[model samples]
Target: MKIEIWSDVMCPFCYIGKNNFEKALEKLPFKDEVEVEWKSFQLDPTLHPDETKTTFEYFKEKKGVPETQARQMIGQVSQMGKNSGIEFNFENAIITNTFSAHKLLHLAKKYNIADKMEEALFIAHFIDGKNVGNIDTLIALAESLGIDKNGAQQALTSEEFNDDVQKDFSEAKNHGISGVPFFILNGKYSVSGAQPVEFFTGALQQTYDETVSPLKSLSGNENSCDADGCSI
Candidate 1:
């Protein structure tokens, strides 16, 4: 089975859902056969690096909410992250553009370390509060992940893999995917949001069954959630 996941590096649910999906795969009979491909998606394409404010401030400003409310929402998401063994320290997370971060993931794909790249970026942004949009920070991350830092810098500085990133966005639009953390199973079944582990397990079982049973498809498309405060 092939699983394609569309996610942004900064999306908390993307990280959580990925964890849940992996756990589900572990329970499946064909887990070893599963190929997961992480596709790039930017929640905030127009957002620039803002050093004066944290992500909490940016959240409050973007949604026109009180600072307290933003904290509460972050708290809820943090608690959810904890359920999946993620320690979310969003209190001081630096808000920055993630287009470069996504590009780095694309570059990591060549080195067969895209999954590690995703985890590293999420940990840096959510726990360490590192600025993923900074070219220097991204290069450092690439170096740590065993990818060529100089090559990563070249790609980030130029238009390398940019079209590949844009193509993912266009495909998401064409598929009516207005969300992050969206999972496509065998390029047919779609699961949205950070659903329960059983939901993913059931999806895996059902997809696997269809391949063995030779059944016809009847159900239509599924709905999903968009990124908070950003258009998908």
Candidate 2:
């Protein structure tokens, strides 16, 4: 089974959803045969890379809500993260463009380490509160993953994986996905949002049965005759 996840590095729900999805996979018998691909999506593509603002301020400004309301919303999401076993320190999280981070992810995809890169980015942005938009931060992450530092830097600084990142965005738009943490299982079934682990487990089980199972009979075979025998 192939699972494609469209997510943003800075999106808190994306991180939580990833954890839930992985847990669901662990419950499956064919977990080892499952292939996962991380697709890039920016929640704030128009935001400047150099612009530094705390997540609270960004939410307050973008949503035109009171600071109190913004914090309340963030608090809810933080609790959700906790439920998913993710410590989201939105207080220290900086709001910055993630295009460069997405580029670095594409570079990691070449080496089949994109999943690790995605997790590192999530930890950096949500827990460690590092500026994922920073080139140096991305380079350090790639280096930590045993990826070539120079290549990672080059990919971030240049337009090397720009197309691949943009293609993901285009694909999302074409698929009518207007949100983060969208999961497409086997390219046929999709689950939106940071749903519960049970939701993912059910989807995985159903999709696996529908696709991998050998037969899908409309009616019972009790009245039918086969080469071996017929029903009495």
Model 1, residue 186: C-alpha shift (Å) = 0.1
Q: Please give each candidate's TM-score.
A: 0.88, 0.93
The lDDT for every candidate, in the order shown, is 0.86, 0.91
119-176: candidate 2 lDDT, tens digit per residue: 9999999889899999999999999999988888788889889999999999999999
lDDT of 1 by residue, 42-98 (tens): 887878654435776787777687888888888899899999888888886887788
Model 1: lDDT of residue 222: 40
Candidate 2 segments exceeding 4 Å error: 216-232
- Error of model 2, residue 51, in angstroms: 1.3
Which residue pairs of candidate 2 clash?
Answer: none
Error of 2 at 170 (Å): 0.6
| Candidate 2 lDDT trough over 10 residues, lowest sum | 212-221
